[model samples]
Structures are given as C-alpha cells and as structure tokens.
Target chain A: MKTIQKQAQALLCNSLLASAVAVIFATSALADELNYSNKLLLTGGVSQVEGAAGGGLTPWAVIGGYGTNNEVGGSVHYTYVKTGDYKLDTYGFTIGLFDRVEFSVAEQSFDLGKLRNKVTAGLGADVFGRNQLTQTIVGLKVRVAGEAILDADTWMPQIAVGLQYKDNDETDFIKSAVIGAKSDHGTDVYVSATKLLLAQNLLLNGTLRLTKANQFGLLGFGGDKHDSYQPMLELSAAYLLRKDLAIGAEYRMKPDNLRSPANDLLFGGANVVDLKEDDAFDVFIAYAPTKNISLTAAYVNLGNIATVKAVGADYGNQEGVYLSAQIGF
Target chain B: MNINIKAATAALLATATFLMAQPAIAEVYAQNPNLGNTPMEGTATFEAFGGKEGLVKIMDDFMIGLVADPRTKPFFDNNKQTFIKAMLVEQMCELMNGGCKYPGRDMKASHANMKVNREGFNALVEQFQFAMDKHNVPFSAQNKLLAKLAPMYREIETTTGDAVPPVFPKAE
Candidate 1:
C-alpha cells in the first residue's frame, strides 16, 4: 500500500512538472503574439484512455492536443466509467510537440466492488477488499508516416507507433493467487493507422497491439495459461456531425489467458473461481464546444469480468456509462 | 417476464431505427446552399462563384489583400496590380472551367525568376482565403477552389533554384 501510494505521488509530481513546462512554453508563445497556425481544426483527436491522442478506447495516429506543426500544445483529461460490478477512474495529461511526438502519463484506479469482499472472505486474506487497485501508465507515441488532413484525398493513411508501460500497485496479489499472473508490470506496443475523409466528415482508425495486459493492467499482467505476447486488434470509426461534434464506435479485443486450475489451493474445491476476459465495445459521442474543451459520453460494454461460476456470482456482461472531460490549449 | 422482454425488444428496435435514420436527415440539412443545385465539382464550382464577374471581383479583392500584406507586397512590386489581377482571374477561371483561356505564361515560367518560398506562398493563400471570406463565399466553395489550386504549389514554389536549373552550365 505504501509503495502504491508513493508511486501515485510520483506520477502526480511528474504530471505537475510536465504541466509547468507546458505553461512556460505557452506563456512564451503568447508573449510573442505569434500567429502560429499549423494543422486544421479538430485534426487532433481527443485524449485516449491512456492519455494518448485517439478515441476513448484505442489510440489513433494523430498526436494529442491542438498544437500545430510548429507549436507545442498539451491537454489534461479526466475519465470515469461505472459498470455493474466495477468502476474505473482515470486522470492524465498529454503533450504534443510540434505535432510530431506525444508523451502521456495516466493513473487508473479500479474498484472491484462486492467481488472484493467475496474474494477476501473466500481466500481468508486481508489483502482483498482492502483498497482499490491502481495502475500507473506512461506512454509515448511518434507519428511516422502520412498526414491525416493533408492526405485526405489520397489512398495513404497516417500511421504512428506507440508504447505504454504499465505498473500495477498490487504485486503480491497478482503473482500468487489472482489469475496467476507472472508480473505486476507490462508494456503494450501498438501501431495505429488513421485516415480522415474531410469531404465526407468521416474518420477511421485501426490499431494492432502486442500485449499481455489483463483488464488494462488493473488485474496485472500475463496469466499462467499464456504469458507470452499476444496480438490484439482495435478499430474505431467516427462521423463528424459538425466541425465540433463527432459520433463514433470502437471495438477492442481482449486476451483470454486465464484458465481454471485443475484443483484450487486458495479456495475450497467446491468454491473454486475462474477468471474470464472478454472483448469490449462502445458507442460514443464527443462534442468539442470550443477548441480548448471537449466532453465525451459513451455507452460501453465490457464483457464478463472475473466471474466464478461455482459461487453463482457471474458478474455477467458489464455494461455502463463512460464520461470524459478534457481541457487544453 | 415474457411481456417485459417483448416490450424491451420493441423499444430497442425503435431506438435503433431512429438512430439509423439520423444520417440521412443530417445530410439534407448539411447541404451547402451556395452550391445552387450544381454538382460539387468541375465547371459547377465556377458557375457557383457567379462565373467571370465573380472571378474578377475575387481576383481584385485578393490582389488588394496581397498588396496590403507586407510579407507579399515585395513580390508584387515589379508588376502592375491591374495586370496581375487580370492574369489571376484568367488562371482561376481556366482552372474552374469557366470557359476562359489563360493567356499568360505557365506557372513554372512565370514564377521561375521570383524565387518564391513556402512562407510567401502560404501568406498569399491566407490572403486569398480572407478575400473569399470577405466576398461571403461559402466555406465549402472556398475549399473546393483551393483544392484544385493546391497542386500548383510544386510549380510555383521554386526557392533556391532547386526546381529549375540554369540554362548555361557553370565553368568548372
């Protein structure tokens, strides 16, 4: 617990430092009163879950923030999601430098709800249900090829490669008992292709990720059944209703690496629990009232999470609402 | 319980139907009024801008804006604004299929001696956008015209003599 708190504090300090630097840059640019125009409006997508620029669930090729090709821009975002059995809150900051590179840091807190108490009682351990599980993620992305807005009429799509390193706070719980994960830290590497059809007001993104993260690192990384890297696909499609408003859908494939053990050592054989991971999908609406602020709302479906069939406590298909608010220059 | 499920299914279907119908409705409302019932391409763009008279006005206003800009004023110092304006009008008319001929020199030949840089060209484009906005040209119409002209950048931007080599070879 102390380690987790320290890590969280470190993350907060780093975020503040990054913000201070961005403010200094912005102040200097303002002092000059330069008309630094670069990219088109709304070409930079909203911040993603991990603080990268993209849709809510998946990262896209475009960098985050409003910075044109010659200016520096940064954004801070807060996101919340509530489901039948779990709740997740994420807060982060992302910076785009000259529209070329993006750097982000986000802290996620996952609340396990009644399942925490059930797991605690079943395992007779004080660790479960004691506190919310937290994870800190640091991400970096670089635009490699093509341009979303400039190449709108061409067959080529903008492409970017990124990596997110995640560190979960609860190391012991993840290693020995829950899902038998090998480590509390994992890194996800992904390549994303994005295209903007400006004339039709349509945007499309496809991402291929190599990861072993379970529930986005909230449940830790790499299960006993499969610890090696696995490939996953995420796709997003959005239609701009207007220059400032967009409606989109995202689908993300999750890895199902947790298999039921032959005999349970933690729980009695009669009350053995198995881990099940399923793909997630969402339909979202994002509205940017101004260039500096945006609000996003979505209906999300995160399928069966940490279900125990023997206990008759299937969390079922987790469906709920997601909301995010972002402000940037 | 059965009736409840039936009602839920009916409601879901209705919502889906309504959501699916939204795009078609939005398309109708989002249509550009300035298009004037013409297809959004080719000669129709010229027609939408009111043909020759409209082209003349746009060129006149654009030249005025360009001259007012300090960054671009130096480029136009040697030429008469009237002649420049007429040539631009002819070029735009020919590009938009206005049934007018561009009697002036080609883009590369005319710009070869100017040594125009990217920033200078961008300034001109900004001025053009301002002129179109001043004339109340619709945003979509402006973009359509600009898209057609954007390909000319390769020919017009010839800074540092990289685009066209000298006719006489340098002595070794």
Candidate 2:
C-alpha cells in the first residue's frame, strides 16, 4: 500500500507538470480571449491545508483562483505545520472553472517522530513500526448561489457545497485491535457560506461539515467506539489591512470519535492520558506580494491526538506554527 | 402583443409592490442623495486625500495610468480625456463631501455604450489604486472611496465578452 501510494504521489506530480505545460501553451494562444486576473487581489482566499480555497483551517465558498464568471483559473500550494509532537506537510493543486466549480487534490504526511517508539513499545513492535502516516485527499466543490464580490452592495453571500474523499495508507495498523479503526478511508460533505463586506473591509465564512474521520482522516476513519457521521461547524473572520494583506482567525469544531470507553481503555489505561479530541483554532496573516503568489503564516492549536503516558509521546494540546505558500494565475 | 404588454405591466407592478414593502428600501433611497451616493460623514476622510486640489492631481495621474496600461489603454487613449478627468474630480470631491457637486451624467447613462467587462473594470480599479498610492492618500481612505465606487460596476459592465471601446464620431 505504501508503494502504491508513493506511485500515486509520483503520478500526481507528473500530472501537475503536464498541466502546467498545457496551461503555458494555452495561455499564449488564448491570451486575448480568456481573462486571467479578473478577480480582485486576495478575494479568492488562500489555499487551506486540505487543498481548498479558504483560510488556513477550513474551506470557504469562494472559488480557488482569480477567475471571474467567464474565465478559468487555478493554483498550486504547499503548507507546513510543526507541532510539539508531530509535523505535517501538505502540498496540493486546485483548478477553478468559470468561478463556479473547484477540483482539488492534496497529499498530507504526518510525522509521528518519537511517538512511534512509544506506540511500538506499548502495542508490540509488530503492531506499529512506521514513523509517519500519509493520506491523499481529493475534493470537489460547486458554487450553488450568490456572489461574494458582485453582490457586495447587498446582504447576500456566496454559498457552496463541497465533498472530500480521504484515503489513508496505513490500512493494517488502522484495522488492528489496538487502533480498531473501521476503515482506512472515508468521505466528508460540507456546505459553506462566505460574505465579503467590502464597505467594512471584512470577510466572514461559515462551514458545516458531516464526517466520520479522526484527526482530519490522518488517523483513519471511524473506530470501535463511534462510527456514525457527525456534524461539525467551522468559522473564519478576516480584516483586510491593505490590498495585499489580510489578518484572520478560524475555529473548527471536531468530533471526538476515538475517545470512547473501549478505545480509552486500550490507549489510556487508569486514566493516564485521556484521548479526547478537542477543537482546532488558528490566527493567520496572509500577504500577497503580487497576484501570482501569496504567503500565509499562522499560530495553530490542534488539541490532543492519541495521548499515551510515556517519556516522549505525551501529545496533548498541540500548539505550533503553520506556514504556507501558494502560486497561481 | 397586447397580452405580452399586459404581462409586463403586471410584472412591473409586482416589482413596485415588492420594493415598497421593504422598510430598508427607504433608508437606501435616503442614503443615495446623488448618483455617487451620499457624501461621506466627517472631514477627516476628505482631508486624508489632501482635499480638492489633491483629488485633481490624483485624477491626472489616474488618467495617465489608464492610458499606459495595456488592459485599459483602449478605453481612455484618444478619447475625451480632459473632460473625463474633470468629471472624475467632481465625482470624487462630491463623494468625499468636499463641498463640490458632480455635474456629469449618472454612471449608467455615461457608460451605456462602452461594452465594459469584468477584466476591464478590475483593470480600471487597479490603475485607480496606483494613482491614489502615488498621491500618498491613506489606504483606509482609499478603501472608503472605493467602497462607494465598487458598486457602480453593476451600471458600468454591460457584457461578459471582451471589452470594446465605443468609437466616438470624429470632430469635424
């Protein structure tokens, strides 16, 4: 499975290269007809961790690029997050068509570091040996109603519906009796509404998601304790300081799918370390030096992931730095 | 034809009733004192642009930038640039509450034949921002004025296709 996923990642890279070449050739031929930079600066939002066009945490209703209603635009992004006990690296690309539909693909690698040793000692060497968990997310979004920019004069907002299918590579470990995950794959559905109040230089977004994944699907989907879909809410607010700069904060509610009685007994015996999942929050600053590129840096807190009482694996209330860079048309 | 006219009349009446029923419509109308919207409150926003004279200089640079940018040059080059600049000055002055009344026609009537599109509109906005930055206008003040003008895109953009500059009859 790891080799297959590696091959898939290689294929994704090759396809991205092919698409970039195609875009270059297409641009010269359709330069006059297709409008490239029709949307205002920073209005398309930056690429989120899961390859969506949004803030650092959750997807917004706006499309992924600077395209207007009559043009096509896209972006490529890389994000890095370092926490007290783990490090996550994400890279992805998105294609937005006619400012109405968005298609995205992302690959995330979560490095467990020293925690791998603790898990191996507790659950036996054969149960867990890998130092990292890798997952691929493929997403699709469609603008359902309203316009974030054109309808700025009114109270209307842009609304969109999106879906993400996540596949984790660590199938055997996830299905083991220790982890007890029902599956290594799952799907998430969400609806988002975003409004850009230009008069006040403010942007607000709200997203409602239904999912069964644990730790954003990095720890696989479902579990022995709870396997049903749960609804989560995410919110973001941003203030435009300048045409090229914005500051924002986000809060994302997550489901505690792995903290049931059975799972707690296995991972946190005698209440050594409660394995309850907590919400995620972040405050970010995004800067666009030019229309072609943007940079985002944030302080993020991703609360508790599989806490076990050990020398170096007490991963609770994780706080870290998030950095991302995006390049697009 | 008679039925079609009657249906149109009914639709117009329904729209009128809907507009009249909304209490917020009254405030919107009252706020819109002129085509440029009501003058902004307080003199601080006005002074930030260096007052009326400062606006004139900004308009000059704005027109020059318009003519130089490839995306917007076709619309301003060889057109009635001096008159357009004067109208812009008056519009900005009135919007900033600088004690000036804009004498030009409303936005829709003036831009009816320009065939403007999203690309052209955005280009014009970029050039305008560049001009304001050149004049050292405060960014916040620029945004306040932009907030007032951004909605005018509804009246200015007439098509989704490529922008086509209207050709005025040559002076005899």
Candidate 3:
C-alpha cells in the first residue's frame, strides 16, 4: 500500500511537469508580443470617471481615488458649485485598495452671501456666516459572490458588497442648542453593487445606506437624537457614448435633521430643483482625455430648503452646476 | 496561320511560373488537423508554408522589430546584437518551415543568463508587432510563425525564476 501511494505521488508530479512543458512548447509555436495585449492581451491603464456630483458619491471625489482592473483605485478631487448666491467649495477623496475594499474623506465650506440677504436677516451676517464641514469614511467591500472580470465575449456582470464608516464635522448651528445631540460624529453603513453589462458600453450601479447622521452636513444638526435608522439611496446609470467618453445621471437621497427652530423632519433628507423634496438629481459627463486622466462636469437641481416651508413652503428655487477634474497614473 | 511549337512551349512555361508565384491556399480548420496543434515543424509544414525564402522573410521582419522596439531598446542595447539576432533567426526559421534544422541552444539554456521576467518578455513581443505592422504582414502568416515560438516560455520562465502564467503577463 505504501509503494502504491508513492507511485501515485510521483505520477501527479510528472503530470504537472508535462503540462508545464506542453504550455511552454505551445507558446513557443504561437506568436505573442510585449504590449499589455501583446503579452497576455488583457486591458490595463485605468482612468477616472469624470462626471457630476451626487450627494451619495461626491465626497469620494475630494481625495484621489479610482477603479482598478476589476480591482480598486482612488482619486483626489476639487469641486466648485453655485446655488443662487451660495458658492460651495468642496474637497473630496476616495480610495478602493482592491475591488473589494473602499475608503473616502471629504470637506465642504459654504460661503453664504452678504448680511442683507432676506434669508439671514434674523441671524445677521455675524451669526450666520460661512462655515466648513468635513466628512471622512473608512469602508470594507467584499464580493461575497461575484466576478470582477468579464468573461470573454459575454455579459455576465460582476457584483460586490461594501460597508462604509463615515465621520462628519459639526457646526455651531447644532452646538448652539438648536438640536439636542451629544456629538456630531456618526457612522453610515452602505451596501453597494455594480455591473458593466456591455464591454465598457453601459454600467448600472446603486447603493443603499442605513445611517444615524443627519443631513449631508449642510445644516447644524448631526445624527438622529435616538439613533434613528435613517435611509439613503443612490441610483446611477452610465453609458459609454464613445470609446473613452461616458455620460450618466444619478438620483441621490439624504437625511433631514436640521432642528434649529424645529419644524417637522428638520434635516430635509434631500434637495432638488429648489422644489423642497427629499432627493436630488445630477447629470454629468466624463471625458477620458487619456488612459490616465479624466475631466467631469455636471448640473444639479437641489430643491428648496424645507425649513422655509414653515414660513409658507414657497421659497423659490435654487439651481447649481458642479465641475471636477480627475487624474490617475 | 501556322502552328508554332516553340510559342506553345513558351506559353506553358509562363503559366507554370505564375502558378509557382501564387501564395498558399487558406486551409479549412476542421479538415487541416493542424488547428489547436502545438506549433511543431514537419516535412509537410514546410511545403504548406512557403519554401525556405518565405519563412526566412517572416523571421527577418520579426528580428528587425525585436531590435527596433523602444520598449525592448534595452534588450539590444544591453546584449551583443549579432549573436542574439543570428540565433533568433535560426531557431524561428527551422522551427517553422522545417526546411532547415534547428541547431540553437534550448529555451532555458539560451535565456538562462538573462534574468528575463514577464515584463521583459512583453517588451520584446511589442517590438515584434510593431515590426510586423511596418512590414504589412498578414495575420495568417503571423499566426503560422507564432506557433513555433510559443513553447519556449516554460523552460525559459523556469530558468529565470519568473512567474509562470498561462499566457503573457501584461495586466498583472
């Protein structure tokens, strides 16, 4: 029996050797080259996806992050957006170590116009001046069951699940007794999945978030008073208009917890076309100038501030446009 | 009109010359039995591919590219140009056309001295493609040539301590 076992082991080793030899011999006979495709012909050189900023993913832009070959990459972003007299300066960054892991950090500083503005006549320019808010997230993504690489000439898209931990910087509005919260910092749990159904032609992605944080950091309020399981969702669809160009639209939802002179749901979970709803729509275009860089621009219609509704919900509309540039090596 | 025997023989000779100049016919993969076959040279392989001169032309172009690619610029710059080119030409030709004998070193022996990795090999292959495109070679002819060079990686990679991938390691 021992001799038989030894013989089996030897046979296995010899078989492996033969297979290796066969592969080498076959390669020698066939002609292959040295370029990415020349060597094994798999695609390489990942670039940024330039486009608009949705409440869901814009923060990921401030830092440098990108998507890798069915893996992970990161990008650093500087963005500018204008809503009426409000000029928003946003800094964003996100990184995906592998396709299964992600992390993001970002900040937004709002420069609310002069003192005489009707909206701020009560607080006066001194009390209602410009403020900065920073948000950072650390996340772990996993492909419990999915493929990141597309099969040759087929449409079996890959899928993955991710959880993001978020930190927010609070402002005096919440610290000054408007909302009753021990702390402004909170965590957001998100599970997202994406698919590239058409060999770079089309992509469909969406995310669901359960969080205690209030607002996207626009108001003085922080997380829910009693740790309410606030819900946030983002749906985005992208299509390759050209071999290296893409255009997409995103619908993002946020939390409503602005409790200053408290009305109903304070934060107003969303903004759109100045319509005062709980969501916003963003349209963006990404231009891949090269294999290593991309430029994106978008238009956003974030509705009315729900708080103004208490004084009669008819506080006119505020529209804005956002632009960003992305670089990858 | 008078029938001229000399003119008739001259016509036949011209027709024969034209037939000899024609390229090989495209083979049906199912019937050829060479499909998926490891690129090995046989007496029949020689006749099917063009004669010695044709096979040599392919090698000549392939070598010129190997030496010219900027990516592989280091390969030639670092090695003795004449020695490398001569051996490459010999191995490639004899292994394909079978008209000549392959008398070069084994894959491992030839590359043993060079710590060539996947990246290095890729650089060389790119140059070959640039050379082929410049020469306006057809894809079919290129395939016929590749079959013979594909098998060297096993021995070559083993000797160099490079990662052994099923195909060339271009993407990581």
Docking verdict class for candidate 2: incorrect
Q: What is the lDDT of candidate 3?
A: 0.44
Candidate 1 C-alpha lDDT tens digits along B127-155:
88788877777655666676555445556
Alpha carbon lDDT of each predicted model: 0.71, 0.79, 0.44
Each candidate's interface RMSD? 12.8, 14.8, 28.0
Q: Candidate 2, residues B4-107: lDDT per residue as tens digits?
A: 33443454454334334422211352433445456678777789999999999999999999888888888888658888899998888888878888888878
TM-score of 3: 0.50
Would you list the rank order by lDDT, best first?
2, 1, 3
* Candidate with best lDDT: 2
Q: Please write out the lDDT profile of model 1 over residues A82-107, one tens digit for every residue.
A: 98888999988888887789988888
Q: Cα deviation in Å at residue B32, candidate 1?
A: 27
Best by DockQ: 2
- Of the pair 1 and 2, which is ahead by lDDT? 2
lDDT of 3 by residue, A108-153 (tens): 5555442124435544434333434444334444544333223212
Candidate 2 residue lDDT tens string, A1-329:
66787687668765874685477346523543443366788989999989999999999999997777767888888899998888999988888988899988888999985677776676576346687888889899999877676555556678899999998877776666556678899999988888788768899988878888888998888875578887777889999998899999998877766643434655454544345667899999999997767999999999987777643467778999999998776
TM-score of chain A of each: 0.89, 0.89, 0.65
Error of 1 at A228 (Å): 1.0
